[model samples]
Target: MVEGRPVGRVGDVDWLLTGSGDPVTVFAHGFGGGISDTRPLGSGVDGTRVFLSFRGHGGSGPLPPDWTYDTLADDVRQVADLHGATRAVGASLGAGALTRLVADEPERFERLVLFLPAVLDEPRPAEARGRFVALADALDADDEDRLASVVALEVPAEFSGSAAARTYVRQRTVALRAPGMREALRRLPALTAVPSADALRALRAPTSVIGCVGDPLHPASVAEALADAVPNAILHVYPQPGVLWNQRGDLRRRISEFLNSR
Candidate 1:
C-alpha cells in the first residue's frame, strides 16, 4: 500500500509525502491534476514513491495568495527533503516544475523524467487561454454540455482513435467535474511561464523527456527543444498522442534505465 504523510505547510499549502523504498522517486502531476495522477507511473517504478499535489490540485488545498513556478519548486523541495527522494518524475506542468527544481538544486535528484513538459519559453496563444477559462467557468457552473465541449476542444485529436484513450478521458473528465477546478484553471496564467533554454542546458542531473506525436499542446518540437537544451538529455517520441501516461512501455524502460544508472 502507498503510505502518506504531511510534509510541509506553506500557508494553506500542505504537501503530502508518500510511498516506500530507498532513493525514493518524487512525482509531481500536471496542471489541474493531483497525486492520484502519478499512481500508475509510481506503481511501475521500483523505489518508494513521493507524490506532491500542488496547491489547488487534489487534496493539497487552495492556491497561495501569490503563486509562481518558483514557489512551487520550493514546495517540491520541501516535500522531497521530507520524504528523502533521490529521483523525481514530473508530468506536463509538473515536468516544468521539476526543471526549475533540478536547475536550482542539482544535487537533490539523481534522475529526472519529464513527460510532455510545458517549457515553451513564450506566451501561449490568447485564444487557448480564453477557451481554458471558459471551460473552467462552465465546470464551476456545473454545465456538463459545455464542459464536454471544452474537453473535446482541449483533448488531442488522437484520443478519438483509441477506445482505451477515450475511456481514460472519460475517467479524467468525471474526476474534473468536481467544484474547485475553476479556481485551478484560473491559476493557469501564473503557471504558464517557460523556463530558459540556457538554464535547461546547464542542468547536471541525468534527464529524459517523453513526447507524444499527437499531442497538440506539447508537440514533438517542444521535446526536441528540451533535449537539445539539456546536455545529454534523451528524447523519446511515443507513437501515441498527448499525455495519456499509459500508451507506451518505452517510457518505463527509459526511466528504469536512467534511475538504475544513478
Candidate 2:
C-alpha cells in the first residue's frame, strides 16, 4: 500500500522497492512506523529507493524474541545487498538500526542520513517511556481518545492544539492498529538505545543528522551529540516539529540537496 510492492522477503522481513537508477537509497522508519513514515524522503530522492519495515512494524513479520538493534540492522543490510544500495535514510529506531549497520559494515553504504535519532549517551527519558506504555494500553483497549491524549503529549504544543493535527494523530493511531503492535511498543525501550559512542565516532561514510525541537523522545541535543562524534557528519535542527508538516517543501529541498551532493 505504500509506494512499492513486496519485491521479496529478507530474513523474515518484507521490503518494498520503488523508483529506479543507481546508488539505491534505503528508507527506514521509526518505532510504531511503517513505509509510510519514510515515504517523504523516499520520494524526494532522484535514484532508486528501498523501503523496509523493521521486525514487527508495517509489512514486516512479527517481532522475534531475540530482536535487537543488531538484528534489525542485519535485516537492513540484507535489503541493501538485494538492491546493491549505497545510501540510506532512517528516522528514530530506524536511524538507530542503520547506525548499527554502518558501524558493523562500513563499506556497505556510501552515504547515510539519520533523522530525529532517538538514541544518545543518556538513558531513555522516563516521561517518554511512560508515553509509549500508555499508548500500548490505549491500543489494547481500542480507546481512540486515550491514544490521542498519549500522542499529543509528544507533539509540538502548537501542532497538538490544532484540530487538523489532532485529527491526523487519531487517524494515524487508528491506521497503526496492527497485530503485534502492542508487543513492539513494549520492546521499543530496549531496542532503541543508540549505538556505542565509539561505533558512531568510527563511521566512515558521509552522514547528515536531522533533529527537531519539541520532541522529547528525539531531542535536538541527541542530534548535536551525534554530529559532534561523527567526524564527517553535519547537523540540521528544525525549529519545531510543526515545521516538518507545514514546510515539507523546504524539508524536501534540504533532503534532496543532501542526497544529490557529491
Candidate 3:
C-alpha cells in the first residue's frame, strides 16, 4: 500500500501517481473536480493508481478556447498511455472522456469503471446544462459564497449539509480556480460525450457502470444506457446520488473488488 505522491505534469495534464504495482488504475475526476475528488474512492483498491486532472481542472494548464470532448478524452488518453494503466475509473466528465476514448480505441484499457455518467450520445437536458452554466457564472464572478451555495445544491439530500458534503463542495470550488475554467464549463454543456452509442459497441474492455437514483446532472438513465451498450458491462445503481457521501465504504469496496478482480 503506497501513500499519495506529489502531482506531476505531462504536457497539459496534471497527474498524481500512487501505489506501485501491476493493474495500474487511472482515475479521471469529474468536471470542476480534481484528483482529490476521486482519489479516496479507490483508496482501498490495490495496484498503482494514476490520478489525472483534466486541463483547467486540477492544477492542470488552462483550457484552450475551443476545447471539447475530444480534448478531455485526449487528456485521459495521454495519461493512460504514458502510465500503461491496466484499468481506469471515471466520474461524470471523466466518464464522458473515457467513453469517447474507448469507443475509438477499444483495447486501450483492460478494465473500466464509468461512475455517475452524465451523458452518452445524446445531449444532456437543458436543466442540466443550465446548472453547469450557473456554476460557471458563479465561478466567473469569483463569488465564493455563491459558488459554495451552488456546489452544495449538487449534493444529494442524503448527505445534504453534512460535514463531508461541505468538504466535497470546497474541493469543487477550489478546483474551479484553475485558469479559464469558466469557458470550459460554458462550452461543455452543448457537447455530447461520443458521436453515438453505436460507437461504444466497439469497446472490448469489461466495464462497471455505476449510477444512482436522483442525480439529475449524472442521471441514472445514462448509466443504464451505457451498461446496455457496452458488450460486457456490470451495472450498479445505488439508491441515492450521495453514494460517495453516505455510502462511501460500500462504494469503495465495490470499486476495490471490481478493479482487483481483473
- Please provide TM-scores, in order, for all candidate models, with all chains considered together: 0.81, 0.89, 0.93
Best candidate, lDDT: 3
**Ranking of all candidate structures by their TM-score, best first:** 3, 2, 1
Better of 1 and 2 by lDDT: 2
Stretches > 4 Å off in candidate 2? 1-7, 140-142, 154-167, 191-195
For model 1, residues 1-262, the per-residue Cα lDDT tens digits are 2346645554545555555567788888877677767766665677677778776665566656566778678767877777688889888778877877776675677788888876546544455467667878877788876776676665566556467556655666775764556665676654543456776656777788888775655666777777787786888888766445456465666666776674
Colliding pairs, model 1: 20-48
lDDT of 2: 0.77
Order the candidates by lDDT, highest first — what do you get?
3, 2, 1
Between prediction 1 and prediction 3, the one with superior TM-score is: 3
Q: Between which residue pairs do clashes occur in model 3?
A: none
lDDT of 3 by residue, 1-262 (tens): 1147877888989899988989899999888777877888779878899999888875678878998788989999899889889799999999999998898889888999998999999989887998888889898788999988888888877677779788888877877766787777788878988878988887878899999988889889999999999999999999877777678898888889988994
Which candidate leads the pack in TM-score? 3
Cα-lDDT of candidate 3? 0.86
Displacement of residue 188 (Cα, Å) in model 1 is 1.5
In TM-score terms, candidate 1 sits at 0.81
